[model samples]
Target: MAKTKNVRQTALEILDAIEKNQSYSNLLLNNAIEKNQLPSKDIGLLTELIYGTLQRKMTLDFYLKPFVKNSKKTERWVMNLLRLTLYQMVYLDRIPDRAAIHEAVEIAKKQGHKGIAGMVNGVMRSIQREGLPSMDTISDPLDRLSIETSHPIWLVKRWDKQFGFEKTKEMCEQNLIAPMQTARVNLTRISRDECLETLKEEGFEVEKSPVIPEAIRVLKGNIASSRAFKWGMLTIQDESSMLVAYALGVTENEHILDACAAPGGKSTHLAEKMDNTGEVVSLDLHLHKVKLIRDNAQRLGLGNIRAITMDSRTAGERFEKEMFDRILLDAPCSGLGVMRRKPDIKYVKQEKDLTQLSSIQKDLLGTMAPLVKKGGYLVYSTCTVDEVENQNVVESFLAEHPDFEGDSSFKERMPEAVQPLINGFDLQILPQHIGSDGFYIACLRKKV
Candidate 1:
């Protein structure tokens, strides 16, 4: 029989993989849990340890630095182990500090020499003896916030400039929170009320989303395992993302294009909104991702969606100009807005990535602009709140393309509750505002 790894050991291995291989924390942790076939309690502990360690990495490091005199000299795995241990000690109220220290030492001995184990024991003992350094001592406010929130200093500075210090601080604090699980009801097959009733019947604590009529927030229970999701009655999606298809406002028999569609959440929602009558052409850059769109469509019983593998930048070459009644450009973005779910993003993303992503977003808009029929609706959306990738990209596109103008009337079609959040034709839903992943949606209309 294979050795049964404890939660801390599993967490250590995951943290090591994340640092050594540049693996995503969520993906790696999930893969590990599934591979190990861990029970629910252990899985929960592993999740908490992995995500909490990654979420409070900088802060934990700040506390660990003074103890480990030569942090630079310490092995990467050792540093990660220490970070994981300290994370549990500082944040997890349930786990006793002595237990955390003992586990760290044991894991260190298993992975490294006795000297290393001794080093781990000494460092953890010192931390318990003397509490962490005061953040108030950090004179620079940005540095303090960055360390306190476990965000990169450069990102904090940028956000401070974009939104004032107080607002940025709130946003950073919000990023540390785990987002609520939200699912969109497939109204073509099941009404929102019916879906909510079914979920409740299955013992799930679900509530209607305040922003979108089709969305429901799951307060408890594994929504993915529910009968509603398995039967295609609900789609696991963020409330902010569910608004993209609504922003398009497609009608029956109206052709729509989902440019850069993949994993088909928005495309599937678009088809559902059309009552499964319109031709929804979904395009993706990769063949594998195109298959994902097909799978989602088949599962949802949505026949109107046609999946194709084609790059959005070259969409004009394959598709006729002014062909579709509506177009959705769910552009790729920095993904800063989703850090709560994917804490690894905070470490991997850099300031330079924003410039590169904005360039690609503008290119996608310019490339797909001609595909919209004259006076047709085109919705550009991203799972990010950065103005450079959202509002600025739309502003730049409108400046160069005189044939299209911002559509301010788009809000009238959205749920009444969300109408006030719309700015002109664009909506920037910050995570703190609605407890949803940060997303930006802009609607434009081609000139007749």
Candidate 2:
């Protein structure tokens, strides 16, 4: 279905927009793929080129510096083209050097004059022939790791302080890797075992999720377009995100609230866990996203969910105190844990953003804490590894609200794969841990 010609050119355009227009790589790439109707093979190459170049930007630039005399003076599109070519030369062993170099030269000539085309050809060939510069040349260990791993130095230092130097290095390395495509089984339609058998019969390669019993690891093929997915037997989601519903520990016929729910991933899971007997009041800030939640619920044939368009902060005023049996505050954060999936976060997220996000996270925690009935649980989660967003925010809320205390009972709902990650009453899953997204979940209970 994809236009076979000019695939590399498509990737180059995407890389340029990602930096020039401050566009998100994943979102832009998806839009391009959908708009162009790319075939699966072209999709694979396009995805690899865009993500590999962005994930290893600094490293590729370092390798190209010696060859390009006017590195900074180079045009943005030309720079992007060189980086994409260099990424293939360095990381993609399957792509031969000559083909990559030729394509870069051709793209350069098409997009610019012969002069820039010659320069692009020279840079790519020289890098391939001369080999990359050694990262050891950098004096500071932090700087060396940052450049080699293509992570920002400030973020690296912060993680180094939060999680020791060794752990930070491992986490940074893990962030460059691609995440697995995971899906959750809709138990309302079929059991996990039955679903797995069905998928196998349909020629899909899959395995049970280590963290979530209801999830499966999509080893091959796009699970979203699978027959099971179209039939509403499963939904595409990461095991780490699916863990939230499991941690909520829903049973039949209980009232629950999902603050900041959108697209209804966790809300639907909570409803299914309740066997469609209880109501899951899902709240989102945007009306379109609320519609998306409702659409997802209807697609999955789960009618127990009630989607609402309201900010969680105003939820306190609208709903009675202690109205919900359980509340989930999956607050927005710096999104540091999800860097592997969205590498653009490495360049755009600053230390100031973290501070602002921490404040918002704290506010959401305090606002949602009261909504949980006494003896009920409030789970605070984020797809980030930062201490300020996870531990510090939860600790601040616990101190301010004497009625709320850390709840350990939630662990009973956890699988054995994540038991070692338990810290006091919370669980912090770093990227290196089990190779999932960097996620944090803390459980709090109302004491009075």
Candidate 3:
């Protein structure tokens, strides 16, 4: 049997992985816990500590600034120790301040000298005596948001510019918190009710979503490695993502092209929506991703999906013009819409990536436009809220392809709460407004 690494130690390793190298917090954290054979309770603690520290990094540093006069690399372990302690004090309600301080001091004593340990103890005690830094004292709106919400300063600024102050702050706060585990019911195998019954029998808590019929949101638990998921009875997907395939309104025997499809979540959902009867050609730029699509489809028992490795920009070269009854161009974008799930994108993504991505989106839309059959639907979707990538890309595509027009019936298929967001033809799901992942979907029809 493997010795159990302490949760804090596991968290430290994860932070080191994220800081010293190129590793995603979610993936690395999951891998670390699994590899080390940590207990489930310790796994929870490790997750909270790692995610809390990363999410509140800016805020933690800001609070620490008052304690440390100058931000130099002095006693690195002490800094991380304080950060972990402060994270528990501020965010974790169960952890008492005294316990947090004691843990910090103990860790400090092990890692550094008595002087550094004393400093760590002093800082935590001071924080416990006083409290978190006041968000009001910070005059700069972006800086204030960064401190209050624990997002990076650069990310706060970008969101502030894009979404304005209030909306950006809300979005930042939302990202700091853990997202709910949402799953879409696999209709090809079982009905939503039947799936829920199966889940209940397997000792999983589930609640049906009021907004989406086939969407079920799992409350506060891990289901990624569950037998239900492995058997393809449920797919780990966001509620907003579930809407994408449904937005396409695919029917049985329809020829659908999922341009830029990979990891096959939406493509598989589309196949399920078609009752596994239609030919769903799932295309990806990379062969590995194409295999991923095939793997997902195979696991789900979705036989109608055909995974292909091809650049969507060259769709005309591969397929006949106007051949597909439905085409879903879920283009590649900055991935800003999924910041809640993948927080590191906030740090690494550049504004220049946007321009390049927008170019790719336009090229993809242009190439896939001719593939949609006359009177058939073509849905363009992106997990981004940027105007350039969402509505503007559609506008530019419509400018070039005069034979295509926006499908007005899209609103009819959408939930009541999402109806008003249907701006003209394209639906822009804002992160702040919908409590859903930031997404943009446009339904269009090829004119005969």
- Candidate 1: list runs displaced more than 4 Å: 1-5
Structure candidate 2, residue pairs in collision: 2-38, 2-39
Task: Please tell me which model should have the higher TM-score, number 2 or number 3.
Answer: 2
Ranking by lDDT: 1, 2, 3
Summarize candidate 3's per-residue lDDT along 4-56 as a digit string, tens digits: 23677667767766766757888998798779888787887887788778777
* TM of each candidate vs. truth: 0.97, 0.97, 0.91
1 or 3: which has the higher lDDT? Answer: 1
Provide C-alpha RMSD values for all models, in order.
1.6, 1.5, 2.7
Pairs that collide in candidate 1 are none
Clashes of each: 0, 2, 0
Error of 3 at 329 (Å): 1.6
Error of 1 at 194 (Å): 2.2
Residue 181 CA error for candidate 1 (Å)?
0.6
lDDT by residue for model 2 (1-448), tens: 1243368989998999999888899999999999888888999999999998999998888888888898788899998988898888888999888888888887888889899999888777777678888877999999999999999999989989989999999999999999999899999999999999989888889999877889899888787877888888998877788888877887899999999899889999999999889899999999999999998999899999999999888998999999999999999998899988899999999999988999988888888977888888899999999998889898898889999988887788888898888877899999888878889999888886
